[model samples]
Target: MTPKLVAGIEPPYYTAVFTSIRPDAPEGYAETASRMRRSVEEIPGYLGHESARTPGGIGITVAYFRDLESLDAWRLHTAHQEAKAYGREHWYDSYSVHIGRVERSYGHERA
Candidate 1:
């Protein structure tokens, strides 16, 4: 399936891509994930995101922000820090985070 798209988002933004392999017994994982989404939205410069997971439990979530400073704030958010620790200790078998500037973007849609 296609990952859910972030509607109305424009370029010159920042995107944080998080990729992870799930642990077998991922208790409280869903709850924490939901909270992280909500928390980032409350942050000053959050834009939106697209997320998807494979049947094998490999997942990717790319969240967008207005700038690197906003992205940096989200990274340093206390709750996010806790969630990162939790993923490392309990939920994810492995993970990687990549951040980049969206220099330009173009798309097409069929009506």
Candidate 2:
């Protein structure tokens, strides 16, 4: 699927920025990732997300939520927690998660 920037999200929201490098032979990674993406959409305060991966295997996914509570919900989600454990054991070479609050934001697009 093509990656697109998430638009129309107002500020005072929270973002979970996940950055990672995949190990060689990441079996079941794509399917698990897709499932996680779908799973996040079902969570109550999910706003949106943007994700991309480079040819060299560096990847980043930024997920937006309406508040810290929503972010925590995602963190404790059973499926998401399982995915995280699987990633650590079999998929990722390295990864980091950074959570931040967006107080303001600005952007532009050409049509």
Candidate 3:
């Protein structure tokens, strides 16, 4: 789905990040993660996100944001807060978050 970017005259600023974690996860972790991914897409300023399992089947997801404020809103969201607690309590063995500025991006189209 296309993101609903905030209506502002300023050019968009993006944050690009990828996270990897250990494989000690709860049962149905993959399914739950899929649901989580879909939910993230519903948030405002959520450009898109995708994840894949590593060679060892550890999960990695890259989340996109339209701006720093959008990123912070996602970080502090209530349900997201609960999921984070759950991850710490039962789901994830360990995980990481990386924040960065997206200086440039390009898209391709079929000729």
Q: How does model 1 score by TM-score? A: 0.89
Score each candidate by Cα lDDT.
0.86, 0.89, 0.67
Q: Over the stretch 59-92, how does candidate 2's per-residue lDDT look in tens digits?
A: 9989999999899999999999999998898888
TM-score sort, best first: 2, 1, 3
Superpose all Cα atoms of candidate 3 onto the true structure and report the RMSD in Å to 1 decimal.
5.3
Query: For model 1, how does the per-residue alpha-carbon lDDT over 14-72 read when each residue is reduced to its tens digit?
Result: 99999989954378887888898889989899998888788898899888999999999
Instruction: Estimate the TM-score of every prediction.
Output: 0.89, 0.93, 0.71
In terms of lDDT, the poorest run of 10 residues in model 2 is 1-10
Give lDDT: candidate 1, residue 37: 83
lDDT of 3: 0.67
Off by over 4 Å in 1: 1-4
Candidate 2 residue pairs in clash (backbone atoms < 3 Å)? none
Q: Which scores better on lDDT, 2 or 3?
A: 2
- lDDT for 52 in candidate 2 is 74
Order of candidates by lDDT, top first? 2, 1, 3
Number of colliding residue pairs in each model:
0, 0, 0
lDDT of candidate 3 over 8-86, digit per residue (tens): 3233556546565656555766676677777777778877765666766477677778788788888887777877787
